[model samples]
Target: MSTTPTPTPIPTPTPTPSLTLTRPAPTDNPTKPLIILCDGTWCGRETNTRSNIYKLAELFGVRIGARIQSPDGVLYLEGVGLGSSFLDYIFNGITGQDIAQQCITIYEYLVHNYTYPTHEIWLFGLSRGAYLARAVAGMINNCGIVHPLRIAGTNEIDAPQTRLLCETVYNLYRSPYATNAPHAPQSLRFRQTKSWPLIGDEDPADRTAPRFHPPIRFMGLLDTVGSLGMPEYTGGVGLDWPVFYDQHVSTVVANVHHAVSLHDRLFVFQPCLVSRDHARHCRRDWERFGVTRQEWLPGCHYDLGRQRFRFLREFGGGWLESLLASRWFGFASKVIEPNHVLADLALRWMLLAIRAQSTTVNYEVVANIERVIEDVTESIRGRAREPGRTGDGDVYGHVLSYAPFGSLLLDVVRTLRGTRGKVSALYQLFFDLRDRLIPDDNAVVYDFYGFDEDIPGCVGDLARVSERRYPSKSYVKWRLRQ
Candidate 1:
C-alpha cells in the first residue's frame, strides 16, 4: 500500500528563462551579460556613415544584430535607432519622450527579447544616448542593490561626463545600497555640447534671471550646465586641449570614494560640437553668464564620433585597439567643467598639499616637478605629434592636450598631506600652463580668463555660460566678516 501511494509520478516543472539563464562563462559560454547601447540621434542615416555603432561593433566583438559575447561573459545589445539627423536627435528626439522614459522602454524591450544572465548588465550610451544610460542605471538601483565589486588603479584622461556618470551612479547606489555595499566608480567621457546664450545676442539679459529666475534657466543650470560646461573652460582659457584634458582628469580618478568599485576598462567619449549658431551663443554665454567657452574638435558632430574610440585607447593607440579594451562604451570626450568655487577650493587644497608633499624645494621635488612637466609635454606632443598637427585639413581648429603634468599635479595634490598656506598661485600656474598650450593654427584663441576684451567671438560664448561664479577674493573676505 505504501509503495502504491508513491507510484504517482511528479510532473516536470517548466524552466524559467530567468532561472535557466546561467552567467556567461570565461570561454564558449552561452549566457552573456547584456550590453545595451542607445545610439545618439545624430548618428546619420546617410550611408550608415555616422554614429559610434561601427566602433561599438568592433568593441563588442559582434556584428550588427549578432549576439557577441566577451571573455568576461557580457552580452552587448546595440541601440542604433537614428544617427545625427535633426529629426532623430533634436526634433522628434527619442520620440518626444524624455530620455529616462525612452530608456526604460528600451530596457524592457531588450529584457523581454534577450536572455540576460544574472551576470552584470551594462549600458553604454553616447551624447543623447547617455540620458538613457543614466536613467536605466537609476532604474537598476531602484530594483535592487548589488554589492561591492572591486576598485583599483587610476587614470588622468579627458572627459568629465565620464566622471559625472560614475559619480551619479555611485550616488544612486550609495543612496539605496549604502547600508550593504558601495558601488564601484566608473567613468564616461562627455564631449563638448553647443553652449547657450545663442550667437548674435549682445545683451547679458538673454542669460540673466528674468524676475530673479526662469524655469529654463534653473533646470538648464542644474541639469546640463555641469555636463555641458567643460568645453567652455578648455576653450575660454586658450588651454592646450590635450594638456588641459590631462590635468583635471587625474583629480577625478583620485576622488573615487571607497564605497564605489572602479570600472577600469570602460571609457566614454563625447566630443559634442553644434551648429555655428549654437557655438556662437555658447561662446557668448561665456562672458555674460560666466560660462566656460566651447572646446570643439573640428569636424561635424558625426565626423568627430571617431574620436571617441581614441579615448578608449592610449592617446596614440588607434581607435580599434582602444575600442577593443573598452567593454562598455566609447565616444569622443566632453565634460561640464566643475563649479568654479569648488574648483578653486580644490586648487587651493592641492597647492597646499603639493607644498606639504615636499618640505623643501630640493632636487627631489624639483625633479618631480620637472618630470611632471616632461610628462605633460609628452602628453601634449602625443596629442598632436602626428603629421596632422593640432588642427589639420578641413576638420580644423585648435586642440589643446594637457596630459601627465596636469594629471600628475592632481595625483600629487590628492596624496599630499598637510598644507603650509593658501597657494592660489600654484593653481594659476596650472591654469596658465593650459592656456599656453593652445595651438595657434585655429581661427581663434580659446580664452579661459575672459581677459581678452579684444576677442569678439569668445565674449558671446562666455556670456551664455552658466557655471557657478568664482567668488572674488573680495567677496570671500566680505563673507568672512559677516
Candidate 2:
C-alpha cells in the first residue's frame, strides 16, 4: 500500500455545487396585479356588447398576452352591471341588491387572489358599473382586504369561508351610519387582525390608528350614473339611500379619472359627480403630478361611453332601423351623422389617461394604444372635413350635407320608439329648451380640439357645449326667463 501510495486516493474534491443566486424575471415574481372591469347595467361580454369597459378588457388582455382569469398572469374580473336578465333587472337591479352582490363578488376575488401590500388594483366602469367600482373601492377603504382562507394542510383557498368573510366585511361597511359615524369597530378589528379564523385577537393598542390595505392604484369611470333603478323611471327607488350616495371617491383611491358626457341632461341619469372637495383632499399627492383628470367630453352618455353603435347593431330593427341601416353603408357621404366620431374621441382620451396613470409600463400596450390613437385621429380628421372638400369629402355633395338631416330626424324618432324612448325624448326636449333659452357661453364651453396638454392629438374644431350651460347659473336665468 505504501507502494504507489494510492495516497488515500484523494477523493476528487466534489466540486462544491455552484449556486447562482439569480433573481426572478419581472414576470416571474409572485406579485399579482388585479383589474376589475364592471360594465353598465345590462352590459357584459355575455351580451356581446362592446362598451368601453369591454374594449378596455380587450386592451388589457392584449397588454398582458393572456386570457382573463389566467393563473400565471394578471387577474381580470368583470362584474356585469345589474341587469343581465329581465327578472334580475326588476328585482335586484331596481333595488340595488345586484350592486351589493357585485361588490361581494369583487371582494371575494380580492380575498382569493390579492397579495397583501404588493398587489396593485385598478378598476374601470361605465354608468351603474362605475357606481359598483366606487362602492367596491369604498368597501376596501372601510374594510381592509380580507385574507384568503386556506384549506388545512393544503394551498387551496377555502372558497366558502372566504366568501363568508367578504360578506361579513361588506355588511360592516354598509352598516347604519357607516359613512357618518367613525369606522365600525368590527371593521377596524378586521383590518388589524392577521389571520382568517378572525376570532378574537389582541386589538392594536391604538384603536384610532387608520387601518386599511394598500390603496387602489387607479379608478377610471365613464359617465358614472349613481341612480339605482331604470332611468326611465324616477332616479331609482333608493336614490337617497346611503349605499348609493356614499359611493364617493375614498382617500384610499390614489388616482381618479372621470370622463363625463357634456350633453347629457336627463333628470333621471343624474351623475354621481366626483366630489371636487374630496378629490382635492384625497389626491393631493397626484394632483401636482397631474394624474387625476375629470373632463366633460362632447356627446350624450351613449356617445361618451361609445355604447350605441354596437348596441344598435345588435338590437336595431324596425322600419326606421331598415332605413338607418341602409344609410349606414353610405356613411362616408353623410355629414352630421351620429356622433360616433365623438365616441371614438372619448375612447381615445380614456386610453391616453390609462397609459399616463398606470403604474406598470407595457411597451406593447403603449404601442398598440398609439396606433389606435393615430387611426382614430385620422378618422376624426377625415370625418370633420366639409362635404365636397377633398377626395375623402362627403361624396353626396354639399347640398346633401344636410341630406342626413332627415336621417337625423328619423334617428330621433327611432330612439323615441326604442328602449331609451321616454328617457331620450325627455332629455332631448330639455336640451332643446336649454339651447334656446341659455346664451352660448363660449368661455365656459370646451373646444373639441382643445387638447389637454397631457392628452395628445387634435379632435378637430368641434365645440362641446359645457354641461354648465344647462344647469348651474344659466338654469336660474332660464327659469326666470331673464
> lDDT per residue, candidate 1, 294-361, as tens digits?
23221222222321211122212345433443444322321112122211211222223333433422
TM-scores, all models, native as reference: 0.27, 0.62
**lDDT for position 272 in model 1:** 22
lDDT of each prediction vs. the true structure? 0.28, 0.53
Best by TM-score: 2
- Where's the lowest-lDDT run of ten residues in candidate 1? 217-226
Winner by lDDT: 2
Tens-place lDDT per residue, model 2, 1-482, is 45654456554443231111011112322244577877775454332345677677766763322223433323344434332443453344333556777888887877776664456677888877888888787777666676787889999888888788888767766767754222456565666673332111223463433333334667889888754433332443322323364534554565788877665544445566664233223333334323456766656565566553221221222344235435464452243223556666777777777767643533233346777767766655565454421112111112223333545655665566456645565444222222112333321334453564433445434322333322323333433642
